[model samples]
Target chain A: MIPARTWPLGRAGVHLVLILYTALCLGPVLLVVMNSFKSRAGIFGAPLSLPNAATFDLIGYKTVLGQGAFLRYFGNSLIVTAGSLAAVLLFGAMAAFALSEYRFRANRLLGLFLALGIMVPIRLGTVAILNMMVAARLVNTHLALILIYTAQGLPIAVFILGEFMQGVSKDLKDAGRIDGLSEYTIFFRLVLPLVRPAVATVAVFTMIPIWNDLWFPLIVAPGEATKTVTLGAQVFIGQFVTNWNAVLAALTLAVLPVLVLYLLFSRQLIRGITAGAVK
Target chain B: MDQIDKLAADVPLLPAATRDAAPARTRRWHIAVFLAPALLVYTALMIVPLADTLRLSLFRSVEHAPVFVGLDNFRVLLTDPRWSLHFWAAFRHNLYFFAFHILLQNPVGIALAALLSLPRLRGQAFYRTAFFLPTMLSFVIVGFTWKLILSPLWGVAPALLGSVGLRGWFHPWLGQEATALTTLALISVWQYVGIPMMLIYAAMLAIPGELIEAAELDGITGFAQFRKIKLPLIWPTVGICSILTFVGNFNAFDLIYTINGANAGPNFATDLLGTFLFRTFFGNQLQLGDPNMGATIATMMFLIILAGVAAYLFGIQTRMRRYAL
Candidate 1:
């Protein structure tokens, strides 16, 4: 307080920059959401204005809801995301535990093998995955998407969870052993509960790609019953390109669930990223 | 208090077990049991398919059976004018895509990160959350929203630009072939700048406070302090951001595919290798679906990514070391 510090950009300047960038980031999204509620005339006439009584319309939403299979698409996405997240967590934790806790032969090689997918996308294997899926008669099945996504997600999950597992106090596991708990019991009961933070991190990382993935659903399950929200929106928007109201409404529908979930879990999500879990 | 609460939460999950419940013998199968599920799923679904795709690239189908044709597909992709023209064009567009992100997105991200990481900054979380909001939205949402906003007839782009005295710059950037790729690249940047910003912000936060305090005492402050002290320290994170940008940019298909369809229309001005691969495998009006060629293109993408990763590992990373804080 005795001597005020000088900055190249004053405090006010810094805030201006931040505020401008924030507006840049948020403006387009707000625009789309705003226009989705406006009538066709309002959308074309005054696209930037907020919906007023004269311009308000629910026709787009009604058309989107009435015409498309968005509910089924959302249900498919939920099933795939839930199924894949469960598989990724349980299997990824087990693998991370084995790789970290127990020093086994070929452990480093196996760990590296799994870690490959963290950098390289699994979509490259689509040609063969499609063939295999067709051969196994698993195409258009939720189980197929779940299994593939589990594979897609496991590498990073194992890597992140493995790092965290290595920090779990050795004393805790040994105490479990001394208490006559089996190794399986120790993992499910003791280790699992302790790594809840890492689990949340993994869930955020895994859920986004699986739910929003378009390529796999497009290739593996393009059928009406199997389409995810992302694919459904793509298809719906493609078909209704001329209708601005329906198009905006469909996109808003596709975006709202994820935006809501993100808002709900944003604090933990930011913590996970900042905690070096992603690094 | 938080640690105690977390410990309390964990206590009830692990039920107390008596000595009699334990098996006398050491169960050697625990490791295998734990590892098998992930291993089986990863190997069968991910690894095996990758290997098979590679193998498929080396063969051509003959009489309903694969005939061994070593590197012929690769040769065709590179030399045959029919395939090579599109291949080279897409490759160039992809490079342009990568360049824009590196030049624009990374710098912008670093700037935003530096601004957000400033001491005593208010509403840091609000800015961060707002900036990252688009990244969380599905590509469909981002693609469609941008498409609508950029539409000349109904979009707010021209109106917004006009209010800011930049009305003449408003055109259908997505519709013009010359501007389409660059426009899409910038749009892609808008959606993804949050990633690099967050990563670099995390790295900046990892820098110890004492170092900054020492720099402050030395009269090194503000932009100078950032240039000399913080910048050097966060180089590793910047390197990571670059390589991730490279991989993500090259592998990008969703936004383009969603907004521009599989054909990547306006005369295929926005076609990327991903969409090209999809069309080749799935067939389109341009050509029949050929798995061997599709595998060949996939293999090429894999090699290109591998090269980039290797360059980062061997060339870039060696120059940067993690400074001990």
Candidate 2:
């Protein structure tokens, strides 16, 4: 039998602290989700109680579906996020590969230059970005958000993926070179697949901020047709602030897609984030 | 497993200095091809806009056209009573916002990480996922969720407090002048504590098991073991997390804007640089939007962030890199 551990906190104590925090973190979210399924009276009258027959209602979801073009907003977000992520992965990986594999004079300087955005937010230039978007007639376009997200994601992508690519064996690339495979083919067929885990990590990291962002969408795409789901929820909630059921349902709708996707990819996300962040 | 699958933690992304440069300079077209797409998009959207924002700050729009008015925008922002009052208040509130994050969020995150890292803990996976759930949700969801929970009319906060014999402590936190900003800060902490916890946990896991076992053999265990052995090794992760929190807080807007509205209401008690910038750029009932003055505020934010980042990269990070092992 293992000896009892000598610690300031007993095992039970540790578990208690964890449980309390878990509740604090999860209680509000669960409260919102459950109440979204309840009637307005049910929500305020019995806030913590799980939905029963008396409390169950679909009115909130109906209001949300009837009013907001949330589906269209979801489509816009999907387009922008997927497009930007694809661009970030391809462009960011290529840049990372070049910086890592090629021994050049300006390589370090270039790497440092690209890494600047990791610390400094791209939002600082929103004024000029809006100007450029209007001038280019790209305002209210998914392309505008996608291009900005690509730039936003590239720095950290290069930072993380560059590290992973540096560890890819030089021998394999050299063997491919000897096999007379073109360099581009080597990158596509060789390096990218080899760095699949890192790419997964980068995808989740790059996808999140783009998805949850309200600022650019609010500024560049506030028109009814161009709203992303996040901006849609914000606008919807703002208009329906007094309508509790609709507000909760709107937030729940905004939340469900991300939560569902996260549940599906949690393993990959957890592994990838932990691996990619290694010092 | 192939070599790539056997990733190790010790390797840095880019090495310090390579003495042997590659000899093939003739067929170098792929290099530009590899880099230009990313560079072009990044420069056009990021670098060019940043430069133009700086330039725009030095100009004023006269009859829908920009006219160069050097230092005048800065003077107005600093000295003009109309602009300066809001500017100074927002600046002061932003510091308070950052302080609450640093003092509260980092410590709580560190504590949770320590507990989660304990040996033989049950439900670790569930707790990790659950804690990170709020972080995954958009700030809109988080803000509204907390808003409903803390609403006095909804009675959840009051009822819970009463159950625990502290009903009087419950107030309309989001609507009160004295408590509004702190309430928002705590709500934000709840949403984001997962980040630092996860980062530190990752760093802790990266610590070699044998090293920990060796410490146990030396009769150093539990909190003492953590204090002496684990804490020193994990300082770099803590440092990184702290800086991340600083950057995130200074750049924060969504929660305050969503829960408190863009006016940062309760008489501007919760106004931050981000919300201030948003109000200036976009305008509200009281003020019409002015892009030049907005750019001026953005430039100031840029310089402040630059100073913090430069200090971290040069001062703290270099020192911590040595302790990362």
Candidate 3:
């Protein structure tokens, strides 16, 4: 039998390690948010404490919100992320259905071609992509980011959806065929609805990267109207680097939305990841 | 074979009664139809540009037009001191950045994952979620947030150091040539450690609990159990995590770019291959942009990544012998 005394010691040690790590992980983010709420003097004086009545200040927020197109940047990020997700899911599912359900000579080759994109970093092709966008007169526009992200997001979406689709009940598709449903109709009406969980997983995986990406926005859409929250925040903070309060507030603003969304979807997000959906 | 015959027999209106008849032609067309749109877009956008980038590296742009100059761009990039120094420096810095992640990030990730996976740990989900919070935020945010918190003017770092009676040790870590790249790498490690942690945690969770229970009955618990029993079982997952870290670290851009600027300041000490490529492609304060040279750098990056991936596939992955349990 195990030694009972040893078990308590081991458990305590585990908690100790965990508690320390948790602090290390959350400390920097906490420090930023905490200081963002304080006046410059208070921030320096009591950096570890929460903002008190005298120290609480909105000057930082006022300055950050006053300068940069923060709200516009958020809207641009949302539209680009949402658009990319919709395209990747819709077209990706359709392609996956065909690859998994149907037999064709080039089917395996096509899948392999799509899978190659996963291994290769898409940013390596930025030189040509910028040129292509310029030729098409689409530079500094949201459409450019949307298209590029859609292309970037497609391979993973198709890979995951295709793998999941293979496990789907084949008898259902056969039954739909017998009911005189066209392949297109079956894909939209039956198959799409059935794979909702996979779609959700794909959305979480795809959206976070797209929403957080700074490279594309910097290169393809850095104009005032099309700047993403990531690019906008970077530029905003860079200009106000000397202003500690404003910089802290801007950082808090950039981090808050993602934190809220993450808390809401952390469970599903973890489940999706551990399910081997992305890998 | 029987299913094929049955499928063929169902369509009795066709001229041929055999299973391998005209219907196969229509079925092929149907498959093509389903696969067309996605294939078209991917090829047009991703494949074509990548292939073009590889091709463009061999040509020099002369008066806004690309002219074939095979190996010339590569020669200039390698032999010319101006181009070669920056390229080699960025390359070495990238290696250092990557080494930091492999050495620090993955080990820390594995350790946290191991602790989090301990049986009956209270608030396990809360710890997991909170720990992963930084990974969800944009790199731009992570970069700037750390930059501000560590700024000498802000006093957060100094105050934290004072709490531990080490206030004088604080420096402008991001602004110093000696410490800048290493600092950025550590900040990135802090933000992304959750990725490997979560991946390894999932892999550890996948190990059969009955095996652990059996080990426990044999007096295997705590560090002894972890070293002798758990580590061997999770080797393949660790291998995968290493390769993932390799690829991710090599391709990293936004963090360094945001925190240190595209120049990767303090005299380019923090510059990595990504920033080098960006500055080469899009001219900064010092130099005119050169597309051909930029493409050449990108092609080199592609080759490096490909070689790394090939090594992982052929070397580490094949040897890691995953446990069936």
Candidate 4:
């Protein structure tokens, strides 16, 4: 009975810690977003407060939108991310299906070879990749980014999908086989539908990093026409460092879409990670 | 049905009907068809390039011609004081960055994860989402955002410091040689702490309630239970997190590059191995590009990562027995 008294105290302490930590996590982002809406003087004066009617300013937004190639960068990011995710998922799933389902002599060796990419950072191979891209005349194009990202993303995607595919019910495939369905038909018409959740997980896992990556974009596709959102914002903000309003506004603009997407899919994303997709 | 059963019994089972039987030629062809495209793409794009990078390290470019320099590029990178200083500085900086991450990021993550995992914690989902929000955003956002917040001109830092009545502590941290790298490392820690927290929280959840109850019965609760029981049990997860953190930190480039440029400056304090390699591969204002030198640097980076992974796998992993719940 005496020990019961300690429970409330413990609960209160836990709540206190969580609340404090949550504040720490949210504070900087909140400050940035709030200040992005205020005039420069208002931001400096009351950094903690929200934008008031009198202090409200869209000058920063106007400047950022006016000078930067924001829309083009956004479009480029979308194309690269979507293109890479599509290639990785399709190829990864197919390879995973074969590796998991078949009993070929070289099956283990093939899987091991694929797993090697997981450990070796793809950037280490940039020298040859650039040379190859130059030789193929693919530099300064979105195709360069897409191809590299697809290759980079495939190993983890295949690894995760393979693990998930191993747990798929074999009875369904067997039934398909007995019904005169071809192996290809079984994989596509039946197996693919069942693995939609894993697909979502893989998409989330692969999309964020590719969208956020800076190296390949800077090296292989840094042309003005091919700049990704990340590189675009970095350059834009660097060029206008002294313009406080524009800098804050550009940073906010860069952060907003991802923030919205994250809030929408946060659960699925966390679920995927905790599900051991990368582990 | 009786006649059909009798007919089936009269015939022996075909080889294909057996569970462990070899697949027919047609099925084998199907396997190859499914596997070929992905293998072709992965090998052509990833494997071939990696091998070529290693091979390129052994050769030098001479007047639009390639000459085999063998170990000369590597020797210059390692032995010559000019290149070696930047290489070693970046290497040491990377190690320091990694050490800071392990010390601060992992512990803070573990602590936050522990609190979040409390069985009856209120607003758990909200806390989880908020904690993870920064991680989903791009490094550009994180880098520039932190830079603005800490900028002395912006007064955001001063204001926050003023609230706590410690306004004298405000300085331009990102501009200081001593503080720049550490400050950036801390920012990175802030952005990524969510990952380890969520992972560790998941591992903690996998621990059974019965074990907690048993530990509680033995008069262990809170931190005591964590240290005495939970810590040992979560060591494997921690191990995995450590190695992941090692690789990620060693490979990290964007944040520093975005925040500090390829020079990684304010006197190169923030320069890491990634930035160093980037500068070497794509020549900066001060130097012409050297592919052989860049390849040598990359090979060294690869070796470092390999050694670290090997240490984790053989040295740390084998010693810790993962508890099966």
TM-score (chain B) for candidate 3 is: 0.93
Give the candidate number with the greatest lDDT. Answer: 1
After superposition on all C-alphas, the RMSD of every candidate to the true structure, in Å, is: 6.7, 6.5, 3.2, 2.8
Clashing pairs in 1: none
Clashes of 1: 0
User: How high is each candidate's interface RMSD, in Å?
Assistant: 1.8, 1.4, 2.4, 2.5
Off by over 4 Å in 2: A1-3, B1-25, B318-321
Model 3: residue A274 alpha-carbon error in angstroms: 1.3
Tens digit of lDDT per residue, candidate 2, span B235-256?
A: 8778888788878876689999
What's the C-alpha lDDT at position A59 in model 4? 91
The C-alpha stretches of model 3 lying farther than 4 A from their native spots are A1-9, A277-279, B1-18
Off by over 4 Å in 1: A1-7, A277-279, B1-27
Ordered from best to worst lDDT, the candidate numbers read: 1, 2, 4, 3
Q: Write the per-residue lDDT of candidate 4 for residues A1-279, one digit (tens) a residue.
A: 224322423877777877888888788888888888989888777777899997799999999898898989999999999999999999999999999998889999999999889989899999989999999999999999999999999999999898888888999899999999988899999988888888998998899999888889989999999999888888899999888788888888888888888888888888887777224
Q: Assign candidate 4 its CAPRI class.
A: medium
Model 1, residue B249: displacement in angstroms? 2.4
What is the C-alpha DockQ of each candidate?
0.59, 0.73, 0.62, 0.60
lDDT of 4 by residue, B1-325 (tens): 9999986875566554653444455578888888887888888889999888888889888997999989998888987998999998999999999999999988998888787777766888899999998888788888888888898877878888898999999889999999999999999899988888888888887788889888788888767877888778777877878888898986689999888899999889999999999899899998988888888888888889989999998998998887668
